[model samples]
Target: MAKLPEGILGPVSGTIGSIVGAKWRGVYYIRSKGKKRKKTRSKKQLASQAKFKFLQEFLKPFRPYFIVGFQNEALYCSEWNSAFSANYKAVTGQSPDFAIDYTLVKLSSGLQPGLRDPNVRYAARNKVEMTWTFQDEPMVTYDDQITMVIYCAEMNKAQGSIGGVSRADGKFVFKLNPRIAGKELDIFIYVSSLNRKLISPTHYLGKLIYASTTKP
Candidate 1:
């Protein structure tokens, strides 16, 4: 299945027989494929695998945000993978029970200026409000967009805004999904440029208990 771009004379790609062809940093090369090995997992290896699997599933819901949130840090890897690498240790706990620490989770990373004196509150049943001021920084712009991630662990669901509000607005009113009412919500916010070329470090806004009409 190897492809010869120059009609059997140029560089090749893909796999052919026992050899695999690929390009790295512009140079084409071929290497014999290594045979797959089966090995029993040690305690340490099992813990690491557990963390990897747990984090992957936890971050799946945030895939859309990672595309722009980790764009600057992606480098040779994908945006999602870059985010996973950066947050692997920060959000994942130790062995025996590698639980995810929601407060330590980061949704974005970059050089963009973040909100000044930001605050969030469960304004009412099914409504949340966020307020912030623009910082006096050279890179700060009125057109910079605000992004938010509101997660409800009770229902294992998340919802948010992406580049839907401007930094100049100073306040945003996010209407929660009706189903999430009464659940505790963890909130995170960050700023990004319209084109997503620049992003700010994610800020954790603590948790809010969405009020419900029904009695506990």
Candidate 2:
């Protein structure tokens, strides 16, 4: 068979391990239940919890992305890295390319005015969107065209019910104009805060995004 894509391996292993472990744990608990043992949470439940805990721990390295008000929230991986590299180049007069990773989380909730009934379940659900941006020095090119590619490392969305919450997972790609001497170039990603009132003014979170450049 052809080789599987490298990205498929991690998710596949996680899924298979979770399924097999849950089944095995469940079987063990069922067998124990017949021995008149004290009632206890099933092995499956425990294993699931353990799995989640393990995943959470594994994901801890990315926690910086979730913290509110992190700088560079609007930048995606490429933009953030590129900007950083470009800034370094601008300041040092040497081009150095690097990469950064980031993640975004958004939550929204609200209450709506009731029309006919004074008290009713008529509150409009809130929505949220997160955006990232990268501002960098301009680039020079002999050709007239530039191309950018965006790849999403991972994305997850949880739909809300009464709150009308929804999540989106994907990467965005855009080609920027060559950097000009006086003009600044920027890349932006954003999540809309629909129906949700902000606790503070909507300033850039500045954390959940990163960027890198392909060229040295």
Q: Give the candidate number with the greatest TM-score.
A: 1
Winning model by lDDT? 1
Provide the clashing-pair count of each candidate structure.
0, 28
Q: List the residue pairs that clash in candidate 1.
A: none
**Candidate 1 residue-wise lDDT, 93-148, digit = tens:** 57656666766788899999899999988877778899997776788888999999
TM-score of each predicted structure versus truth: 0.87, 0.20
Candidate 1: stretches off by over 4 Å:
7-9, 16-19, 22-34, 211-216
RMSD of 1: 3.3
| Cα distance off (Å), candidate 1, residue 115 | 0.2
Q: State candidate 2's TM-score.
A: 0.20
User: Tens-digit lDDT track for model 2 on 97-197?
Assistant: 22222222221111211111111111111212222222221221111111111122233211112212222222122222222111211111222223222
